[model samples]
Target chain A: MQESVDLGPEQCTLLLGAGITGRVALSSPDGPHIVPVNYSVVGEAVIMRTSPYSVLGTYGRGSMLAFEVDWFDHERWRGWSVVVRGRANVVTDPLELDRIRTTWDPQPWAAGARNLYLRLHWSEISGRQIGVGWDPVETLPVRRAV
Target chain B: MQESVDLGPEQCTLLLGAGITGRVALSSPDGPHIVPVNYSVVGEAVIMRTSPYSVLGTYGRGSMLAFEVDWFDHERWRGWSVVVRGRANVVTDPLELDRIRTTWDPQPWAAGARNLYLRLHWSEISGRQIGVGWDPVETLPVRRAV
Candidate 1:
């Protein structure tokens, strides 16, 4: 085991853009819940579509949420994680929705009438990579969409 | 896209036991944060070690937190996730420490003085699998160790 290495802003943003799915951590009435959702990174904000009855749909609007994307290698005991913390808002504007839909839209995996779209405007981004000298971005199995 | 299938207790426990790494979501003064850690299941409780200043070590004790483990297949548009909602407790008993040390102790990946051990006693466990019928455990790239 080795001390984790802090990732810079560029590294954090690149890692977030590489993955299509990430976990969103939000505070609910019961407690904190982490739910995995497919998301798209447009500018610095994360955009996702969920059902109106879902946790993110219900309590995510105007709330501070943490979005995390991570991958680990058990063989080498190394992992890299990026967390984006910010306020979420419901995207109702037709123009903004059109831009996202044409460029990079988050396609929901679960089947339903997902009319609610939430955009998490990131205020803070941080990450860490564990293990010895190695470039996690180069070694990552998943690559950014071309 | 398809409707998510609810997983039963037996399936959920089996899935949780299969993974060595998972994300822990907890509430702090700042907001909700998700941190990935290597963990082990001793019966129904999750055993983990973290630094005293770490989020899990500081605010997690006696706090209701949500722990999640999941994997996704982008090509198939499928994934499975198991969530454990519970109250976390610090492990101080010498005897209990010995038991965990002897069997399935969580091996912390980040090197540091991790003197604090936290156990999350699950009060509620639930899971969901999305996409057409398929065993996520079977299709998962990472298999359980013998």
Candidate 2:
């Protein structure tokens, strides 16, 4: 963890929403298969769909994986990013899928809907935020208002 | 590509601007470093930045990497995602950095400025977008709008 790369509470608040998460897939010393997925954040975990035929299906489930979601506003010269380090596994419980389907919206844009939902339950959560004018004290006083 | 995945073109258009991009680092066998970054589309390439001492500085440069940027409007069930398969390396040359800096803004949010510009030169670029109401046909044409 570098001091220069610091993400504050304000930035972390933004990442809780349902955004497109970058799903990173690691090969077994073979090659690379990475995909962008639409996901919903549940508690400390990030969840998305999977295809049994895809590389993610092969490497991600029951494996250590990484998931990230970010937002940046250039005009304001400000941005925030969140990274979740965890193990990924396929969700098989019918009740879990039903609950997810009730609240979670899996917007698949590809040609196939395999409906293989995966969850990356975070073991370590770290983030950093960068902006032009971020006064810690100025923002600190506002925190008390909440 | 799965047929059940409904991706639309509007999602692609949104990802082209200064949106969120995730960098997946697979250096360590167990935990791959995933970081969210603010990025912009330069030609077909995805460009982003980080601090000099960031995790990306260690695992990112000269590595076979996967970069994905996406945005979703959950309320409308509309979103688009783009994934780039390429090698990521730090732009060392001052002229090259100058050119990238002109197009990409990698300023951090904390106190001091810590922006280390990098580019994911694409070897294979593919994207998918999905929208709710309209038929996937006219909204998400496969070809990139040049």
Candidate 3:
């Protein structure tokens, strides 16, 4: 079995910056809720836009949430995953919203009035990579026999 | 802006069967956590394997969790996402484990002693799709200009 490696803070941050889409997990009154989101990282915070009535928008403010991104190369049987635990806050300041709009505008693919922008201030960031010695680009022919 | 459509239970099940990888959300004492996982659906339950001491393995049993899967077509600015809310349970029956192992062998890429298998019994299933009239395969030339 190939070994898995933990990624450092700097490497996790780099991976977060390179990602465009991720899943955000939040606790709701009913249960744990998660959804796919388009996001942008700004100054150690993850920013996303959603409808005010959406699950994320409703329970996001001052709530503890987790965001994750991952890449998997199926043929090579290797992948990397990053998780960010944070407190989410609504971006209400006009100047800050405008600055974020100008710097990194997030366009949510789901068509709706997604005007509310939430910023998650990360308290913990962790990452892991599987199949340490495998080449991501190379396809393994041995798997074909299975 | 394109219209968004809600998918019915049958369509949601179809989408779930088509996906192999998804993110699972669980609430921990610290906060809500989300991670990517490889899973398979069998008899209305989603099954995945993980290390016994892992966060998911430790906290998943009898806990309310959310599972999500999505497919995005960036070129056409369209996608579909499905979310399943369920309670997780550990598969302890040797006969059932053997059945699952024979039917849908979950080969987790992350190398470890992942002998524990968790099954999620879904209570709610919902799905949504963006860009109702747009073709998923058609490339939009307007995106190139930006």
Candidate 4:
């Protein structure tokens, strides 16, 4: 079977920049929640706009969260996944908000007043890629009926 | 701007069945992490296979986690997102394992002995769709120069 490869920090960052949409995972009072978000990599943080009343915007600030992006091919059974873990904080500074608006101008695809921008200060970034070639199932030993 | 529509439980489950790939979010000692996994809907739970030593395999069992799947169109700026929250459990019963194997064999694209089957017993399923029509930005009031 083809082996998986570990991606370095540089490679992970590069992949993060290339993707515009990803899933954000956050721990909330209700439990862990995962939601798709449109984000932009600005400086060292991932920034996205959300409504203050939304689940993410309400519980995300000051919480540990994870952001992930991946590309997979089901036919070929090949893919790459990147995960970033960090603390999420609201962009409250007016100047910083303006800078982000001018630089990235993150537009929320869902029509709403998603005026609040949140930045995840990523502390760890890691990724892996499932290279193409052999299939895992094809290499597995035959099983006897129970 | 076009108003977003809330998807019912039945609609959410329908989308889940149609999609084979989704992201699983779990909180670990380091922090929360999100990773993509190919899954199958069996009965009322989402099941997938992973390595016993993998982060999801180790910390996912009996832990509260989130699973998300989405389809987005960049040109149209429209999409639908579904989130499932539940506790993940490893399928240990031999009979159940045999049943899952027969019904839907989850083939891991990544190479390894990913024999451990993990199921997320979802307690809440919710989804939302961004309907096509007007754009929120176009309806926003003109910004005054700072």
Candidate 5:
């Protein structure tokens, strides 16, 4: 039987930054809800855009949330996941907004006006891999673009 | 930009059941968390197992949670996600447990004594797709097991 390995902080950060999409969980009126968002990692924070009325925009700001990205190999039955625990906030700084656009704007695939720049700053980052010694993210089946 | 399509409940259930793994979100003491779990669909419930001390086992029972399964086609930049909102509970009934074991048993890859059988009964389900007519679940990049 294979054992799970704890990933280092640097590997966690690298894999988290390379993914264009991940799921973000937040508390909603009905219950706890999670949804995928296109995100760009800037420094110690993740930036994504959504409409002002979306579930994320409505309840995400000023709330502590979790963001996760994972990849699994079906043939080998191996997988790894990076989870980020942080507090979410709306991006309101003019300079930061300009820098976000200049650095790399997160372009959400949904067809709507994704005008709200939501940022989730990392307070804790951790990861684990079931298949040790294998570079899972770099060798993804589809090689998702960074 | 292509318009997003709203999928019916039946299509949502089919896609949700076809994926062997998904992210389950539960509210924890620190904040809301999301984690990947190997799951199987039975009747109106999603069944999986976890260690009794894990975040899911500790906080998931009797709590309202969200389970999501999705597949994205990077080449076309299109994707769809099915989200199910429900209350989770520990499976303690003998007949139901026997049925779960008889019917396809969910095998968690993680190495541990996963004694707690967690069942998330779906109270609501909804889905949306970016590419209107294409079957995203059937054409998954890696084709995750059902």
Candidate 6:
């Protein structure tokens, strides 16, 4: 199994819970690209599907990137966030595709968008927590559990 | 006017358009706090409001945090996203409070979920673009436009 880089509790639980996460990618001089994709935690990595015209189709292959997922409230004044930094690539192997399809159900927001599955291999993972007891902004060891 | 963090096109545009974005904070030993906030771009920063009991209040002074927004589709496979890194702090000053109140409209999904406004003084901002074009990943310097 590949070594997973686990940042912290803030970052780890987010992947475990199926939540909407943002996928950030680098644009080639023209513009910056952003996309919100559905993700599921498979062991130690984030797996999701992108569309054909979607940015994932173009940038999903061996691209340096960042992925973030977070939630917050104003009245309660408490929330948490997690960021995973690493390279994102396409999952082309048919066996892997079958596995992801069985485990993760990534559906498109709008109709007619093409679909492509991609995975982010996290290199550096870090996270922060707010409004629990005390001790915030703890960076976890690589792939260590909370 | 307060200084705006330099963000790439991806970050700026996403903050301006996406329907949902979230601010992530770390407070407890369990994990980072994640809350979905409704926000609008004012000047150059992302703004949102929370009540005294809000989780953001527990983040402490000079707390490190992030605000993220994005849009994506799986069919055609095209989308974009943006992330803002900055310090999370309460708005105690009257002028700041009035400004936040005047500019921000925190429409919580549930009633009484928001009341106070917290402005993140952004610092060291960076983001990337992916798959919008032929190139996969593009990393660029972040700057506020206009």
Which of the numbered candidates is closest to the native, going by highest DockQ?
A: 1
Fold similarity of candidate 5's chain A to the true chain A, as a TM-score: 0.92
lDDT of 5 by residue, B1-146 (tens): 66788889998988877777899999887789998998888888999899999999999999999999887766687889999989999999999999888876888887889889999999999998986767766755443343
- Across the candidates, what are chain A's individual TM-scores? 0.95, 0.75, 0.89, 0.87, 0.92, 0.72
Q: What is the TM-score of each candidate against the true structure?
A: 0.96, 0.68, 0.88, 0.86, 0.95, 0.48
Candidate 6 on A69-137: residue-level lDDT in tens? Answer: 654433444445566656667778988778766766555443444467667777656654445643223
Give candidate 6 misplaced runs (Cα > 4 Å).
A1-16, A134-146, B1-40, B43-146
| Lowest-sum lDDT 10-residue window in model 1 chain B | B137-146
- Index of the highest-TM-score prediction: 1
What would the per-residue lDDT of candidate 1 be over residues B1-146, giving only the tens digit for each residue?
67788999999998998888999999888889888988988878988899999878888988989999998887788889999999999999999999877778899989888888889989999999998678877955566563
- lDDT per residue for candidate 3 within A1-146, as digits (tens), equals 55778888888887777667788999988889998898888889999999889999898778999999877765566788889999999999999898888778778877668999999989999988887874322321111111
Candidate 5 chain B: worst 10 consecutive residues by lDDT?
B137-146
lDDT of 2 by residue, A65-111 (tens): 77665555434545556677788878889887777777665656555
Reference-based lDDT, residue A71, model 1: 86
DockQ (C-alpha based) per candidate is 0.79, 0.30, 0.41, 0.33, 0.69, 0.06
Q: Which stretches of candidate 2 lie over 4 Å from their true place?
A: A1-33, A41-44, A93-111, A132-146, B1-26, B40-45, B101-116, B132-146
Q: Please say which candidate is ahead in DockQ: 2 or 3.
A: 3
Which of candidates 2 and 4 reaches a greater lDDT?
Answer: 4
In model 1, the runs with Cα more than 4 Å from the true position are B140-146
Candidate 5: docking tier: medium
How far off is residue A119 in model 4, in Å? 0.7
Q: Residue A37 deviation, candidate 6, in Å? A: 1.2
Q: Mind giving the per-residue lDDT tens digits that candidate 3 earns over B1-146?
A: 55788888888887786566788999999889897888888778889888889889888888999999876665566787889999999999999998888778667876678888999989999988887875422422111111
The C-alpha RMSD of each candidate to the native structure, in angstroms, is: 1.5, 7.0, 7.6, 11.5, 2.0, 13.6
Q: Candidate 6: interface RMSD in Å?
A: 15.3
TM-score of chain A of 3: 0.89
